[model samples]
Target: MAAGCQGCRTAQHQFAIAMAFQPIVDVETGLPFAYEALVRGEDGEGAADVIARVTPENRYAFDQQCRVAAIEGAVAAGILDTSARLSINFLPNAVYSPVACIQLTLQTSKATGLPVDRLIFEFTENEQMADTSHVKNIVDSYRKMGFGTAIDDFGAGHAGLGLLAAFQTDYIKLDMELIRGLDTSMPRRMIVEGVLRIAKSLDITVIAEGIETLGEYDVLRGMGVRYMQGYLLARPGFKTLPPIALPGELYAAVA
Candidate 1:
């Protein structure tokens, strides 16, 4: 237990929670680079459904609870059998102290026999962080702890390049809106190509997420994007790892 952490007592008093896992596929191998854990209600409710009930009083508890659930759920789902990493989402604002906040996560990792190097924490940029400096601290602290950090929904967010300039994480997940119909849109392709160059210069790996069509996948692969995720590959599995839905032609093309 984290010493003097008050949120521990209030964790999950009002509800039960679980995790759904969606793999971020590595295009070269057609296997997962990592599986992103999504929070869900026990009966399989979506994230938006579960998040609407969170209040400030329980925010910290909920955040802690989510991390624990993601780890335990992933482990129980046999993540140790694979080479893929596990990615969990965290709220930057609820983290009062990075070291203090991560005690449980470290403990869960130890208990699950999942190495810290195989864990990545992803914080979305869709919501502007109340304190950019604090997030940088979180990223720095996580990196020091041998955990990878990622910025989710990169291009469609508020801070955009400003946040990227603030601190570069291990991975950037391009938003679905930017990847949508990318094959048919020259402007979108140009924007993504520019981003790929920036990521390369910074040594930050780019993961194109929310890809749903063959053309989008083909175009992204051609642009040198390797990691990807979304409905076209596999949907989030409720408490399990779903088999990747690979079309024979698509798999042969990528393989």
Candidate 2:
């Protein structure tokens, strides 16, 4: 970050925060594919309370802080000891020059002994963007730099197909609404299946989030979704990595 941004970050330091990590599971291995770093307050408050600290004037600093915080926090929490990647949510709008802004992140990872390849930057599709090409540029730059990128809350927001049609990412997480009660809803199943076909053709991995029931998990796995994240696996652990376990009934059935 530049001196001006450093000043801004220093001024905004009161945004005292913590990170919570929830693993995204891979069904085939039944291990965490990656852990997503969720922003929380220092006292264990929710993300909203911390996110509200961000303003137009301080957005750049806030975004920069989040990146460094996620990297440092994950490393402090033992992410470097595992093969699973560290996924951090980012605000694309705050990024002026992807390459320039990423210098700090690269430095932080290098200092922390965390491989750059083990980092994933995920952005919510619901986040409004004035320039779609800028976001695509960020993705392309991240890809060239060996960083993974993903679209979070994929189907429930604006520019879903539009963004996919424009640039490709490493992963896209399906919105929970589509995954909710999926087994019994033909429309939901059909939609998810269509997305799977598209994702397959694009060579993009699909991660279904908000899976809370066995029926939902069964239908998704049957539909061939191997990557998933939700309460069914584990919840986010503030400043820690939560353990993940698949439903025992599944193993019993296999037995």
Query: Best TM-score goes to which candidate?
Result: 1
- Residue-by-residue lDDT tens digits, candidate 1, 180-233: 999999999999999999999999999999999889998998999989998999
lDDT of 2 by residue, 1-255 (tens): 365345443544547888999999997888899999999988889999988878877777777788888999999999878899999999898887788778788888999999999999999999987799999999999999999999999998888798899999999999999999998999999999999999999999999999987889989989999999999888999999898867674556557
Cα-based lDDT for every prediction: 0.89, 0.88
Per-residue error for 218 in candidate 2, Å, reads 0.2
In candidate 1 the C-alpha lDDT for residue 243 amounts to 83
Q: State TM-scores per candidate.
A: 0.94, 0.93
- For candidate 1, the 10 contiguous residues with the lowest summed lDDT are 1-10
Q: What lDDT score is found at residue 51 in candidate 1?
A: 95
All candidates: CA RMSD in angstroms? 2.6, 2.5
